[model samples]
Target chain A: MTTPIRENTASESPRAELELATRDALGALRHVAACLARRSHELLGLSCLPGPAGQGRLLVAVADDGRLERLLAELRALPEVCGAQLSRAAGAALVPAAPVAA
Target chain B: MTRTTGARLIADSLVRHGIKAVAGIPGGANLPLFDAISQTPTRIVLARHEQGAGFIAQGMARVTGQAQVCLATSGPGVMNLLTAIADAKADSVPLVCLAGQVPRALMGTDAFQEVDVYGLTIPIAKHNVLARRAADLPRIMEEAFAIAVSGRPGPVVVDVPRDVQTEEFDFTSWPAPRLGSGPAESPGTPGPADLAFAASLLARCERPVLYCGGGARGAGAEIAVLAELLDAPVVTTLMGLGLLPPGHPRLAGMIGMHGAPAANHLLTRCDMLVAVGARFDDRATGDAKRFCPGASVIHIDIDPSEHGKNRAAHVPLAGDAVRTLGALIPLVPARARPAWTAIRASLGLAHPYALPGLDDPKSPYGVLAAAAEILGPEAVVATDVGQNQMRAAQAWPCHAPGKFLTSGGLGTMGFGLPAAIGAALADPSQPVACVTGDGGLLMNVQELATLAELGLPVKILLMDNGVLGLVRQQQALFVGGRYTASTFAARPDFVALAASFGIAAIDLEPCRDARAALAAVLAAPGPALARIPVDPDAHVYPMVPPGAANHEMILEKRHDHAHS
Candidate 1:
């Protein structure tokens, strides 16, 4: 009798699948810069850090401060980002500060 | 064929021949070919300087063993490539240079940027061509590549006009050109009569020596066999550094101005000198009339002009090194003479001219010795000019053929890193180690990006002495230590610079940890840098002053004061 070939089940192979998914998700999210450039305003600061499951951190700062809330609302509507949060931080350092209750 | 410009055809032909990269400096006359290249599949790399372009092409050719092309716009641009092109000729590297010429329509008009490139390069190049028409481009390029790489490889120049490059042609393809066969037949073995005479002379001689040079490089195994057969010590010229293993039992260090004391001592004492494929250059044999005062010389080389050019030879055998050695190896009998062996052993025991403070517990010699031990004999070592080159030549023990590569003849300052890149590209399996000084490394620091982009695993050892070591030493010994422009300050952080180029770099200084640093760098799987800071005042000793007699070599400075 021939032995059956071992097959990877979805539950057992989630890590590799998650890696592929995360890369695609982050790649799409990064392309948002080009999209925003078509709308208005020049990009002030843009940073990207790799994360898990085709997910990655992207931070974009604009010259105008009020634009952050509107940008967050647009990002939340996108399918790639799992969640969106916005807060004001010191502009010089570009560091994330404690979230101001929204 | 329909009417077309020579430049377009040449560029098209080169592209057809699988040329991917062309390094050059653009100018008026050669702009046509540049236009064609810009439109063709070939990518043109603009060099900051024409000389740099020539060396870059040389590096590329040395790695590929194929003819790499360089272009220069006319006059000074073409002249700039002369040194590197001649270097390629001497080192047997293959390259083709396209020099822009004044328009053929205005021939002999002394057009702007016009120079007689062919006449200027006649003595330096393997071949040269001045395209008479647009139709000549395809055939000329084919012949250029053929001549550049055939037999003893060298550079070939093709001068084309601005009009020729822009002219369009209907020719679909370049016809292949035929190349001539190998060098004309050279006398292989010494005549029976000459062999008998040489044998008789050797039998009567008390001390006989074998001096080898660059011509003997490809015949290492044969040279070793001949050395064993004759039971004589072998010494080489500077260009013949890696021809034979430096540590061979029968091998003596290099012979010449900067040659070892033991080798020169043996040369002075020998009764018979057998020169093989060596020209006995003035640097090798100072005052040829006085060199080997006691010896009768037997010279063997393929070039007949060199037979008696430098020194008188009793037996001049004109042949390739392999064939000449083949003829001589059999005539000499292998007899165990304990007396001769004892003399050789005695010469071996005579300590090498000591570097005054190299024996210090912490010194560059220790670092070199450790490196030699770790890298072993098979490691390919390239050195930049100055004290580091001299020190590496004296201290590093090369055990195999082609293991030591340096810019010996040209003594190029920024040669180490790029040449190491070439050596690494040539043989990926072997480890390439470059020993460069801080001053020399900074000369071509831009090459760090090339190394990183190519992902070559070349290990660089920087000797940071905060001064141009050789110049400083010369000023100290000859000039009154005025220092002049030799002082270097505000050096860049090499580690950070290397990091910016995506290369790993470690400073082997502050930690005073050369061993660990070297080991770590050597063990790394990619290109890395290890900077070792030496005292700025450190000088290379045992220097024979320029134009001074060899016997008057200053082994050490007379006082603590620096010579200016």
Candidate 2:
């Protein structure tokens, strides 16, 4: 479900991440990964971690060219996916610049 | 506790789901499952090709608006069924595909008929499960049907190993009753504010066009009511045909490439586009970015992803057509826009929708019209892609949803014949018309034998041109008419071929009264093929020439571009 608004389009971003609650079952990640690949969203990174029994969390980062909202909707629609939400960008570990090691 | 093999459980699941017939071709990997299903009341249809079986299932699903089943073995069988699965996904058809795989022990040992059905189907299917244990049969089968017909319905693949099928499992009882729901029950509904906003927009916009698509099927009355309420002209996409009667006054005719110029022209001038359950497919929306450039959108669809994937909806109402329209209808007041009506009429008069030689029974459009007239309104039409498809879209008078079945989203060439068979099987009482061209017919020609055996009232209107009509038309229009592989070296004598297959066939080349010949052939009984000799130079006109704007059609007549 989406909030009905006149200007609901996702703002443009070069990269974005989606956090998903998924079933901890065989081939469940395949369904999530396939959704991104089908839409030609270049997968930047993916990490899956075991949660409570029969539950898993998938954090996926993809190259987004202003199509993130639509992609988020598709990811949420997957059967194995219990929930999916766009992650806050500032929390991403991979920043463009970092302090050099001396 | 009841103890049963996984195969028996699957058969019981099929019975519990109210499936009377399942289509597929059995192979080495799936013999156990087939044996178990045979023991049940469900009749198994042995299709000549896996692809044929898949389309047969699609046919039933499309006609009945419910989930249908198809079976296939591993490796080659799964591979053959892939196209149909992809087609179902593209067109949003609900299908449960049960595929057999190698045994658990030999699964990764390079065993005979070993293929990774899960990985191959992941991208195409709504969801796919690899049933690794015999104990998982009940849950897996229930989930497969649930996922298939659920939101934005699509095909689901359930791959069970041969060992799992034969291995005995103790199951207390079936998990649930009727895991399947009709096409996901149309997702969600629009909020009251959303309806008010949409109604306000409708009231404000001077020139509004209601664009509907496949998702709008089974909501004909709602669409008609909305069109009337808004005083708007309705433009249906290729998949959205029969949402309203052909004679409906508000119909601007089908839109996009290979669509009517009047409707295409009207689209350019509309101020508001009320897209009812329509996804703006590239074929329907030529140069997506440029389609309805100045118009504000009120997008309504069952799927959330569709809303802003292409053109952004000014007021996106994410819900099924019926519920959304049912709510919005009362909010909007009835009014007439004479200017809009006059504009539509002027455009229509300039570009008369009726094709040239439409009355000639030997012509492309003529044969389909004759078939529809002879078969009457109850007839279901399933068309193969290309010129024959466009002709049927243009000429046929489909009165309701599901009456016109085409591989709209996938545009699969071999879909018509087998799908027609499935449609006929869904309701043997009604007649089915299969429209196909020379190119598409050969792709699934084996189904002709299936049609012969079934002896259903499926009148195949074969347009036999020496070339792949659409490809040749494209080559002619865009490629400087190089005349390459589009032309066939030698075509089969369709009449003789039909006779060889023990099915009656008639060629209209030499017939003095083609109308009467078509009538007699269509009316005679079981299955018959009528071959109409189409001119190789003939092409579907008002084409939006690839990558062009919808307004810039390559019209067949100069008057199409002339201002009235």
Candidate 3:
């Protein structure tokens, strides 16, 4: 089986999380989803929660393909997003000594 | 406090923003918005198709350097406009698309003309918004215009539900009308440190090239000055054409797949590639790994995502091109590079871009040259896709930035006719030229009726090859000479077609003096069409193969197939 590119926690496959600080703008969640959907196979999981004073937080779990820097830049470019951060490692790293797929 | 309907507020907002005219078609959900616009002084140019409407608005926006508006209703209207919106975003044209949605309750109930416009436009548009409440109309309308012309200019979509359009709300004083949110307010405004880093890099390199794109359109003078100061040659992308004048001493010409051989070869030898607002697109840089292989890049663009997306840069100065170039110019010392000049001259002589039969008025290049001479340097030309577009790009004497309009990023066919109409409508003083081919003209032939109705001074030059010339050429070269599905079995009588659309027609095939006939048609005050029969076997010269490097070009006439 193929190893995970970026897995911060214990998981069966490749996964990385991004925590987005956003404000409650119209269709703000859809903007994030749209950005992820444009890339081939990026979105694995996503969740949004409302915070104080119209502020909100979005947790996105993705299959990091070493393009997360550009992906984060795209996300942060949105007007609705106040900030975007990769809660996982800085860059995608290969899982250590995993079994090869036959 | 006064009260006004959401539609009236949107219309008033348009008027307040100084929008003189809008282009669109009326539909079920957008009737109220259209009616509100009718009540105001903003004139509506009705188009046959919503796609035509979008392109018309795009033409105006491109010419005026402002955010022009286009309207479309739900479902099919929105779907039709998606191409233009995507085109605007790709080329960074400032446009505001106001699309109507079904009433709030009927949105997800599978109503007659309802689709998820918000979801559909999200990926294509630079910014997307949905008006769920009437009270949000003022803020939404204001932000739409601001966002469109802000930073790197691009299209913005605002999806208005029918109920939201008709719902009345208390009106506070309007927000200040805005053209942009300020170039410095956006992300990637370079600091002093970044400018210093970029300047030092440029000052050190002996063979420097300033590669520009559409984002640097507003800073042509600065680019010219920067090139002179650094003793560098300036190379532009397709979108960045016409930024420098025709015979500017530093202009190395356009770069990419179909670019000039001198410009393409120059990239391989440059010691430094200072990309000004250029994105290093695949078309501009073939085989990215091999592009500018010997050079260290200093990329300056407003978008941070483009910094390391394609080719890695040694110095990434993320900011507005005008400000960054201005800041960097003063720091670099002026010097003469005779060695680099000699190298550039030799490369140009070795691989000159040859347009044979240019002396004849009937050929593609000759027709474009004759038309350009009669129309003058002030005229704006819009080209359709494929061979016609490439021909116009290579031959059209583009005098300024916005004068040369083409669907560069999307390469969409059927963009020429309506865009020429829009350009004429935007500025009546300058003549507009629409250079198109048989296949592209047929794609949007319906707009000919619209052109007749408006009676604008648009000259449509038809290069009739009876087939898709570019596709046929590629099929001949790469696909082993099988010209399948590229040829048109029965071509329409274009001269008669123009007459049927209530426009003047001229065919250069039998004309004794084709140049005089063309000059007469282009000089006429109203709409006209000229059909020039082109040889189907004619191929655009010096094409770089799909996966090959810029230097590896397939020359013209090398693979000629003698078959009908």
lDDT of 1 by residue, B365-393 (tens): 66676777777777878788888888887
Is model 3 an incorrect, acceptable, medium or high docking prediction? incorrect
Cα lDDT tens digits for candidate 1, A1-102: 111211222222111100011122443344345335544644666656565454555555555422333344333423234444543433343453332221
- Residue B471 of model 2: what lDDT? 85
Error of 2 at B294 (Å): 1.2
Complex DockQ per candidate: 0.00, 0.24, 0.17
For each candidate, report what fraction of the true interface contacts it reproduces. 0.00, 0.29, 0.23
Model 3, B328: alpha-carbon shift in Å? 0.9
lDDT of 2 by residue, B1-564 (tens): 998999999999999888888999998889999999999999888889999999999999999988899999988999999999999999999999999999889888878878889889888888788888889888888877777776678898999999999999789966752322222333667888888998998888888899999989878899889899889999999999999887898787899999888999898889889998788898998977678877989999888888887778878887777888988999988889999888888987887765878788999988887788888887899999999999889889988889999999989999999999999989988878999998999999998888898888888899999898888888877777777899999989999998898899999989999899988898887989999999887878878988988998887754322211
The numbered model that scores best in DockQ is 2
Which of 1 and 2 is the better model by lDDT?
Answer: 2
| Candidate 3 lDDT, B1-564, residue by residue in tens | 779999999999899888988999889889899999999999898988888999999999999999999999998998899999999999989899999999999989989989999888888898888898888889889889988988778899999988999999998986753332222227445778877877787777888899999888888999999999888899999999998989998898889888888999999889889898889888889988778888878888887788787877877877888877787888888988889998999999988887767778899999999999889899999999999998888888888999998999998899999889889989977779999999998988888988999899999999999999999988878888898999999999999999999999999989999999999999988999999999998888778888889988777755455232
Query: What RMSD value applies to candidate 1?
Result: 29.3
Looking at model 1, residue B347 earns an lDDT score of 65
